[model samples]
Target: MSASASEGPVECGGDEFKTDKNLRTSLSGLPSKIVAGSGFHGFKLNVKNTGDRAYQRVDFGVFAAQVDEEDYFIDTSHLTLQYKDPASGTWKAISLDETDEGAGYLGYTDVKAHESFSIDLRLAVDKSAPAGLGYAISIGMYADDEGNCVFSGDGSYYEFDILKAGTAPGDPGNAKPQGGKKPLPQHQPAGNTKIEPQGHLAQTGSSSALPAIALAGGAAVALGAGAVFVVRRRRNADSGTAA
Candidate 1:
């Protein structure tokens, strides 16, 4: 019960302030999976101002899987894409006014102590974006205080996989995970075969002609036999001339 034991650590105004134990800061209800090649899809981030006081300016980031290449904090030249005003409970799309370094920062005037606030982001997937299976998208948060700004403890990061397009809903194709090699072709080529077949000339008169010649010979033999029988009958009639 000494005075020193009774006094807990003092809270600093900047990013150095210890997070409120009861004050929960989290991001759920995300898209869970984003198709890699789909057009602009809406994504939401729920940021609850759980601290004792409202946050004046909090900087957040949206990053891909590879954080090494992502510069959401350093580069803010891109369009705002989305923002919500805490007072009106309405959301608005922020046009890119300037390409300055501070453009990436989403500034809020006052986020109430117990109330919750959220920002919906609409990020377009590059037309030729690679597919993702395990961990595709990542999100980070940093409280903007002057002194402790770039420090590590001021940030929170989350990782998620991108839902690949060209896949039927509830039907997950065996697409290679992001960062994986392409699958080999399954069918082998039919060697030396033409894709389009050439028209074959009918055997011309080769086969049909022989059969026709045989038929003509058969008819001649039949006519010769008939002539011989008629001659014999005419001779018999001559022998019986008087009768």
Candidate 2:
């Protein structure tokens, strides 16, 4: 959904927020490891900023491994990244792949101290995902320069149950309704039903009525003038005949 980056507690606004301060990077919450066939809707991890400084242009490592690799941890080669805004609770799908080292996933300080910021981790369901539920997901922060980065071995691993392969999310053969379905017509009763008369009031200050009224008034005035001119012409003709 949404996320926020700020200083101090997430609720308060104060002078404790600062830009130059050092930010504490942490991978506190990890999403439950998923199986190959089990369906998942919202997979989220929280990358919390525990320090006071505004963090920018930083790199974070994401690793996923099957449960079989318990002896030696293996990283998932294919990775996708997305972001959630803490303030608005909006989740935006990010198109960046694992190669996007310097872009995507950004956060800033919310207070004067710049101690607090949060990043929501997200992933979508893939058909080819692994089946066994036992897996590990981890991350580490790295500096832009080579060999300069923050690495905490196995930040936090969550054990999850995996579903069997080829399992669907919902009922089988049921298709979601699309917008192209036509609405059904309403059925009327066969008998003579006593229906209540529906009424509506004319809206005041309508522009359409004004033009019609002006046209009618102009026609009436023109007719009155023509009538007067005809009467005067008739009188003048009678006088000329009498003369």
Clashes per candidate, residues 3 or more apart or on different chains? 3, 31
Task: Please give each candidate's TM-score.
Answer: 0.39, 0.35
Q: What C-alpha root-mean-square deviation, in Å, does candidate 2 show against the real structure?
A: 36.1
After superposing candidate 1 on the true structure, give the runs of residues whose Cα lies further than 4 Å from its correct spot. Answer: 1-25, 65-104, 133-156, 163-165, 169-243
Kindly report the root-mean-square deviation of model 1 from the true structure over all alpha carbons: 42.2
Candidate 1 lDDT by residue in tens digits, 1-243: 000111211112322333333223333433445555556545555455444654332333233221112221211122124544433445544332222222223332223455454555555444344444222121212223322221112123233344445643353332221221111111111111001111212222222111100011111211222233334445657797421
- The candidate that achieves the highest TM-score relative to the unseen native structure: 1
Model 2, runs deviating above 4 Å = 1-40, 48-57, 67-81, 85-114, 125-130, 133-148, 151-154, 165-243
Worst lDDT run of 10 residues, candidate 1, spans: 188-197
lDDT of 1: 0.30
lDDT of 2 by residue, 78-138 (tens): 2334555454566554433323322222332222132333455554445465554233233
